[model samples]
Target: MSPNYKFQGWMGLDKDAAKGKMVWQEYTPKPFEETDIDIQITHCGICGSDLHVLRSGWSASLYPVCVGHEIVGVAVRVGSKAEGGIRVGDRVGVGAQSSSCLKPDCEQCSGGAENYCQNHQTGTYSSKYPDGSKSYGGYADYWRGPSHFVFKIPDALPSDVAAPMLCAGITAFSPLKRLGAGPGKRVGIVGVGGLGHFGILAAKALEVDKLVALSRTSSKKADALEMGATDFIATDEDEDWAAKHANSLDIIICTVDSPKMPLAKYLRLLRVGGTFVQVGAPEDRLPPFNILPLLAKDLKIAGSSVGSPAEIREMLDLFAKKGVHTWNNNVPLKDANKAILDMDAGKARYRFVLVNEKHVSQVERNEARENKL
Candidate 1:
């Protein structure tokens, strides 16, 4: 299928773009193949990773990068060989991942862990395809990618709400589900921001016995409680906060990436045999912590990336079934630069999703009307 539309979006030509300098420009997308699908983006969520990449915080980002992964849009072009039964005009989404080697011999791919596929895993933006073409993101008018990474959006979930779920929601959902979060388990979500908010929502949906939200201050206390957190910990206000909650939770999902975070104290909040999963990516190395506590309690520390296609599908179904709602502020796609800056300044209520006025569908418009009622 040939692309009949031009690809254009807000591109960060250099590091200064992180400081609200991104320019609106037309860009070229990767060569489309029979397995590819083209989407006219309606909404794209502003993720912390976008800011990180804009400034090359994690690594030197590719020049002229269009950075966004939490993308929801209408499928305008579907290749004949595309999978997932995607069709033209279907509401769909794409996440942080764009491609991975789907070889039969690859253990990760065969085992349903394609997100961890070591061979040829490609990010949605600032990444290159095997053909040496750059993969553009959803911060623009359109996005083209392999259909394997694209997903059909559920009718029950609004596009603005579902956009962040593609990345932030799945990032939290995968770890909790994998670590056995459910009725009998207690879960603690550290850092109540974009990813942490989803962690609280997912833990609540999983029916955890106790859900605790830990943050530096009590600013997000009400918001966390409204999101179904049973307990809120103000780390800055309470001196004995860690001691008070000692051995309380079975799983702790740390979503903040500060090297100076009280790592050892956070470990102490875990019960015996508890697991602490680190999903936040910090540019600097994590601070050294005492290993004796880990050894004493037999605690385990692990890391999780975004979920696989199967897991993403499972999460979407769960969101629809459980009626999970996201706390998000919508910004115009044209003001993406300002939105990114606000996101970096911690001004987002929880998550910020960019709305492309030109591409919003009737269904999304209807969803907005219903929400107002």
Candidate 2:
């Protein structure tokens, strides 16, 4: 399973690299194994985590890091022992996770919660395999990783649109589904950025009774409504916004990471026995909030990480069935540095997907055939 192609990508050499200074260079990938697959990357979605890692926000990032997780491409090589029926030329994707301890005796792995397998969890980038080789990501010409973490992209989903779903879509989908967001539930999605946009779409696809898009201002009101939100709340415009929407929603998924966000007011928006799940990762600690609301209203506040492999498959199937369209702005792969800067500045309409023109002809051909059908 030796890689025939040289591993090359846009790498962040240091903290300053976050300021649109990534350089194109060749790098070595992890040692290939029978369970691995090599992907000729075509599209990679720019995620907030990429920026966080580049600037060493979460922690010290592995130097010369290639930071991208929501990746889609054509499989150029598939190991004989690779699971999931992956084959050469098949369009596939990799998410935030690359590997975990899948040993049968491990509780998380055996219980279908591999993403939470703390025993040996490895991120797609800035992580090390058990063999001590550094893992690279998909802001590059090719990606090499374990096939178990790779997924076959559905024909109904285009590469550019499908890229963000691996992280943003699933980040929103997992919590909504876990909290039972359907028919009778009123769901509120806080923040209308890349992650929150998918939250609205996922809740809508689940057929929740009401979908509320909450933002600091009304700038994204129209866009949210177009994405199936039943209502929009402008917190900044209304001084009594929280009071106005008090006890209105059964579940709220907070996608904003501001430490100073009005936590108490957000909790007040939930009905009795409601649940609030925080998915955004803030570098600073969340401001302390009163717990009286939780005790009085029987409210539950929690956090969710990315979805498991099984959950990802379920989300893809749901997207295919419901014709869910991701609001994406596609940028050429060479312009990734600029794209990251734009994303950091909140310029993306929803999500920023990097398209590698060299490998996108296959995707174009597929799109053309699907269009004719």
Candidate 3:
């Protein structure tokens, strides 16, 4: 028998709601199916994407959307058709994606790059399923979605820290793992905040030859170096920063979401045949750039989204095995408005995870402690 629970949460009714005006109200969730699972959310990470979609900064969003994609919770109900062998009462998580076209004929899905599924790709928030039903996100008391996108949280990972890995961590990890950032590779992570922090950790776990952290100022130099970055570049501190670091990196993961970012200068830091990845989502269009750098160095510029379920599982195992830790701040669910405001004001030390107090316990909070890598 199905358990009865209220599908309610903080919902954004209009563009102005992004300013910490989200209202707590009951909302309709997608119709449940045999292939779906119900998670009683315990922790949800507040991401920049939530703020963007709340204000319709990316594109027009469906009103009353509850946005938080990095989710961690207990599986209260599991469908027999679920793909991951999930069971009730199991700790699990879901990322920015909820559903995708998983047909074998689809090249991207079949090729193990399901994150790039071109057909019927549904975001966890502000998106509609194939049946036209609204797919809500983790900012609610409960979440119902395709189990194929759900992943079992490793026992060694604390829910508070594991929550952010679903999105921010995977968004950074997917690119580095896919681009071969290890051993002989010299990698640079731009912006030492949410996504970039995880980028540095993942690269270090992969054992890169050199890890460089690029930021606007030297404020985060100590933190970045402690997070496995061997060198730190304060761009605003050095007017000749570009020339100083030219042709030094084989791979650069640019995580800043500004149109005015020094894109050309960043490209110059890449060695010949290097790859530059832009994982940040910007509200406005990026500035136009010269093609000379690309033409001269044979550089490759690409964009990466969150990882697939397989990749998510792989990341969890790697983090657990390496004893890696994320610098995270915990905010109660009721204080979501304040949390989002602080997040917008750039006050989060690294990442913010909303804790549903009624659902969390001391055991989960003190699950395991790893080195702050």
Which of the predicted structures, 2 or 3, would earn the higher TM-score when compared with the native? 2
Candidate 3 total steric clashes: 0
lDDT of 3 at 148: 91
Number of backbone-clashing residue pairs for each candidate, in the order shown: 0, 0, 0
TM-score for candidate 1, please give it.
0.96
TM-score of 3: 0.96
Which structure is stronger by lDDT: 1 or 3? 1
Candidate 2 versus truth, CA RMSD in Å, comes to: 2.2
Top model number, lDDT:
2
* lDDT by residue (tens digit), candidate 1, 192-235: 99999999999999999999999999999999999999999999
* Residue 122 miss distance in model 2 (angstroms): 0.7
Q: Over the stretch 1-373, how does candidate 2's per-residue lDDT look in tens digits?
A: 3555789999999999899999999999987888999999999999999999999999999998999999999998888899899898799999999999999999998888899997998899999988889988889999999998999999899889999999999999999998999999999999999999999999999999999999999999999999999999998899999999999999999999998898899999999999999999999988899899999999999999999999999999999889999999999999999999999999999999999998898667876997999
Please give the lDDT score for candidate 2: 0.94
165-253 per-residue lDDT for model 3 (tens digits): 99999999999999998899999999999899999999999999999999999999999999999999999999999999899999999
Stretches of candidate 1 exceeding 4 Å from the true structure = 361-373
Model 3, runs deviating above 4 Å: 362-373
- TM for candidate 2 is 0.97
Q: By descending TM-score, how would the candidates be arranged?
A: 2, 1, 3
